[model samples]
Target: MNRSSFIRRLSLVAAAGFASLFATSAALAQAAPPAAMRETMAIGDEPGRVSTEEVIIREGAFARQLVFFRSTEPVGTLVIHTSERFLYLVLGNNRALRYGIGVGREGFTWSGLVRVSRKAEWPDWTPPPEMIERQPYLPRFMAGGPGNPMGSRALYLGSTIYRIHGTNQPETIGHAVSSGCFRLANGDVIDLYSRVQTGTKVVIRHAATL
Candidate 1:
């Protein structure tokens, strides 16, 4: 073939190859999970970015950490301030396991001085009258199990209905969407439950200050 004729044929072949590769990639993308399913978990800042890297629990997941997000505070108490979305378990040398929590919404929010009066593994959940009334579609009570909204562990806060409990809805870990309950990820709650015992002081501070 002449030089110009050979060049034209080569260019045509390259274009066809590029088109085939693009087709394959589009098909693979379509076969993957739906866009809604892809967004089941929260993605901060960037939309598609997710941190699946496993958080290593050195001793236990509940074994406290040594850092405080809030600059002011002595470091040896369990302070839960819902409005701020922080749960600080002070480790004394100026730090705490600052787990992001989903606090109660609007009228459902509350504040009080309570203690961790009871602890349970995979605790049963009976929606309070207000909760049942608010979300009537939910079952009156859900048995303790893996799928239960109250996750792997629970620390009942005093004699009231509030609890630092594990949530099946792990994606809601750091938001304001509960009924006056302090909600955590299942892994974190189980860790917290194991270290603390009954009568551990649980001070629900003003959500604004903590």
Candidate 2:
């Protein structure tokens, strides 16, 4: 074959090979699992980016479970044991639905009896004055979403700046890292939110009290 003719044939073959590769990639992508099914958990700092830490928290000991609990509090009450990093919803008959939680760090920890004054789903977040003062780099206001630190739900505690809320950082569960709020994995918080309502009694027990 002449040089021009041979070059034209080679070019056609190269184009066809590239097209085939693209087609195969598209097909594989279509066959792959959905992102939601594949990614079970995400971190607050990087939303939708799954990591080993996220998987360990979501499927490890931190996952929510029903457990035998001894509490004088009536059924439907919320009990938080900050030292153990667990929150229990009194279910009567000496039982409770327990969720792993992230409590306040060091000086931020407190114990008190409070009530759920209100609730919100995917609530907007405004860093409290104190929080902003401590971490001046934080946003003044952040709209709620997957990327938002507030996560999926929030149960406001009485009139205090504290709340039992969801965190995008599932790995934070079973740790002490919050400013003062009690945080749960997004799924766990959503479950808790559905089972409680405004006016629900919340008893917070710190390490000293527990």
CA lDDT, every model vs. true structure: 0.55, 0.66
Q: Write the per-residue lDDT of candidate 2 for residues 1-210, one digit (tens) a residue.
A: 153245335544654565456545422233433221222111122232322121213444566788999888999999988767888999999999888887644213446788999999888888667556545677888887666667788999888877888766555566555243688877778888899989999998765421
Q: What is the RMSD, in Å, between candidate 2 and the native fold over all Cα?
A: 17.7
Candidate 1 lDDT (Cα, 0 to 1): 0.55
Worst 10 residues of 1 by lDDT: 41-50
> Could you tell me which residue pairs clash in candidate 2?
none
Scored against the true structure, residue 159 in model 2 reaches a CA lDDT of 84
TM-scores of the candidates in the order shown: 0.61, 0.68
Cα lDDT, model 2, residue 31: 41
